[model samples]
Target: MTQAAADPRYGAAPPPRRRWRLSWNDPRTRNLAVQAAAIAVVAAAVWYLAGNAGRNLAARHIATGFAFLHRVAGIPIAEQPIPYDPATSTFARALLEGVLNTLKVSLAGIVLATILGTFVGIARLAPNWLLSRLAAVYVEVLRDIPLLLQLLFWYTLLQTLPAPRQAVHLGPAFLSNRGLRLPGLVWQPAHSWAALAALAGVVLSVLWARRARARQDATGVRPPVWPVAVALIIGLPVAVWAVLGAPLGFDVPVRKGFGFAGGVTVSPEYAALLAGLVIYTAAYVAEIVRSGIEAVPRGQWEAAGALGLRRGAILRMIVLPQALRVIIPPMTSEYLNLTKNSSLAVAIGYQDIVSIASTTLNQTGQAIEGIAIIMAVYLVISLTISLFMNWYNARVALVER
Candidate 1:
């Protein structure tokens, strides 16, 4: 054989690379192509809807732009967080006031409901026959009734009260068909400094709490931090006020002429809305809390008891820590429900975001803009609450190494 054959080397060539194909032959590329197609379809549908809306709007001669938001609202609003005169203020300001009103009631309702629910939930588990029965009745009654009926009932009840001249007075608070008037703070120059001092005290209290928790983790000894926190929060603020000559003052609502003149007024509509939201929401929260508490095994409680821990301590330390892991997810849903239910304020004329936005839509004939604004406001609020709860859930969740 020749030298090439003796070396076992022959003419060799690499196979020609196949032309790249863009189909499911490659799983990844196919998946990406499918997703791209889906996105394109969605985008096209949105564009079509937009164009159709514009044409219909033009045919109807209804103005579609948000420029109308700058024009005078020309509609009366009975309740507002900030002073708003429709004759004087722009529609934008009116809408903003509505958003603020919605937020005010929502935040207040959450706090009150939470506190009320916690008590009712604990009462459900109470050994005393009367307490548990009462709790059960409350939960069943409130939960079974329609929230709309509750709202209307409360509104009717508030409207039946006597007028401002014959207002029911209780200490610094007054109630009447006109509204519930509460003594409001009359801010003095020193109050600003006092507020700052109070804020500082809260920061210090949080820091001290973390330190105490860390110390307990290391040494198995937990110092009571609640007393110190209370002192720092309440006592420090009081001390600051005293140092500044206690310039604390109040604007007490007094019967003046035909109506109360001084103090913060919670309109009857607002009062009913808040009361209804709190009561309706608390029932569900109570159930969630009770279920969370019960989720903890009996063995855990018995073990804690055997270890010489008081019932209260066991409930607080061992049971709650475990129960919270179950509670937070459902509790978050209840909060969201309360927020959405606040929209029912419109039915009773409470002037929430949805109510005001509906008025704006009618007056301006800008349905799209008004609806969009309402949706955006609610989305932002719901997301904020969800994010905070999610972060807290993550912190409390069991961490397995």
Candidate 2:
């Protein structure tokens, strides 16, 4: 400043030119250079590996394309949701079936684990000593043991049950060494129309809810919507079912062959995987829930109590709302973990995506493609879950503004 003010010739300072060589002293330049170099190395490594793989495949006379997907799978799938015959089906179709099986277990496991975990979490905080201790014991015992062992144990236990002829029966349901068979709903073509009607009802209900919310916001009065909700959700569906000739039929399991047939057949392998995933995930979720509940300040509970609110009312109106803000974030992570862990079903012969894809890889000798397919599927699934959870977290987050 002194030099610029003193001399008219040097009235303004010149901007410093960037150096041609990256200076270690300049943090921005150094970081950029290091990142660029690292990226270049990684890119080179990937290109080299791909080239090597191509040469190896050519040398071995092995095909390296997804064209095999259209070829006959010639592999029987037992847990298929839809009809498939190994004699006529393609490998791509089988792979799709494997994906469905994975989703089927993962989605159901998520719901069941959440419910059971919530119960255990509440029990852990119970006023009664016995209940809390029991919940603590359960969490400690189940989470500590290896998950694979749990799957194996449940699978073996199911296998030790009586045969189909001597099954444990409760009305239409039957349990045996093979699996548990229950009443299954057979969806006919007419049911498609019924489903569309139900979907329409759902859309209408959502629109109605928005209008109701707007009305309440303006008037500070909430209308009773239970009757409308019930009629739209339940009555509309039932009316559609009846109008569509009641196309739904139940297939009740009966002792027919060595194993029960002609009903919703839950194989032992599937049951074991489901049970293990649910139990293991529930323990982790329970701890998360307990911690979330504890994170809520005690003063809030006391204030609600002093207002003469009943126990259940205090919990529903004050405690739970605050607790849920904390609970949801960790709960989302647990759900993602449970879904990823479904791959472990292969150990129990559950024929999830990993299992079927691995078998296909071994038989077809397309190791790279098989692994790529698995990785792509998992990547897509994880990304989808992450995006959805983030959106929901934003919705429930506290607004400081």
Candidate 3:
């Protein structure tokens, strides 16, 4: 054989390289082209609509910016988380109060709903026939009913309660048509310091718990967390309070003539809204929890039991950790739903962001700006919840080594 043919480096001329060509047939190229076109169309539409709205508002002698937010808002809000004088407060402050009120209801609803729903979910799987049946009925009925109707029903029901003079007494709390009046703390500087200390303790306890878990994973023995947690979380706060003279004053409610004074007053509108949202949202959360628990294999339960583990211990240690991976994603959605559903407070007279925004627009005639504020507030809230939940989901997700 010739010298050139004998060597692989001198093999027949290499096949010509195929020139790159874009085509609709290529999935990646097609997808990018389609996405770009769609984005451009959306951008153009938004720009044109905004310009048209501005021009029309100008022609009709209406204002178009957020300048109205600084103007005096004489809107009387019944429930203000912070001090607000309608005559003196600006529209921005009023809106901020609205935001706080919304957060109060939404956060409380999420917490209460989670606790109640988890119990209901467990009850649905109980051995007792009656308890399981009752739980099932609750989930089915609540899920089927319209949330608006429930809100209306609860509001009407609360309206029928006896007046403050004839309020039902339960310990330091009173229930009346006015609303629930609960004993409150006469807050002071010492309490504030103690609260800060308690918060700091919580952060420290969480860090310790994480470190303990890591130690347990590396070694065989797990360190006790409760003792340290209690000392930091409870003892630290108590010590702080003691150092500041231990001001433990209570603001007890007392009836004057028609209404009560001196205690924390929960308005009827807030009571109705919270009752409606918590009860309605809990039903769905129950179903999600139930499904997550059932997703654990029967064999895992049997194996744990065979190893002489109690049912509760098996659940707490072995099953729940796995079940959480399934539970968190759906739970995040429920939280978001509860937050958004709070907008319905407008119907019940609760001065949430949406309700306050509507009143603000009517008074100031900044229709676009008011609506934009409401939209922006909810968008930010939703995104924040999503990001936190996503981060937590990633933390609890299964990892294979």
User: How do the predictions measure up, each by TM-score?
Assistant: 0.89, 0.90, 0.90
Residue ranges of candidate 1 with Cα displaced over 4 Å = 1-21, 212-228
Q: How far is candidate 1 from the true structure (C-alpha RMSD, Å)?
A: 8.6
Global fold similarity of model 1 (TM-score): 0.89
Q: Judged by lDDT relative to the true structure, which candidate is superior, 1 or 2?
A: 1
lDDT string for model 3 (260-307, tens) is 887998888998999999999999999998998899998999999999
Roughly what TM-score does model 3 have, to 2 decimal places? 0.90
lDDT of each: 0.91, 0.88, 0.93
lDDT by residue (1-401, candidate 2, tens digit) is 68768897677567777665667888778889899999999999999999999999999999899988998999888899767889999888888888889889989999999999988998999899999999999999999999889999999988999988999997899988888899998878677777787788888788788888888999988776667777787788789889878776898887886777778888999999999999999999899889988998999889999999987787778887888889998888898998899999888889888988998898788999999999988888778888988898888788886
Model 2 weakest lDDT span, ten residues long: 12-21
Looking at model 2, the pairs that clash are: none
RMSD of each: 8.6, 5.8, 5.9
Give the candidates in order of lDDT, highest first.
3, 1, 2
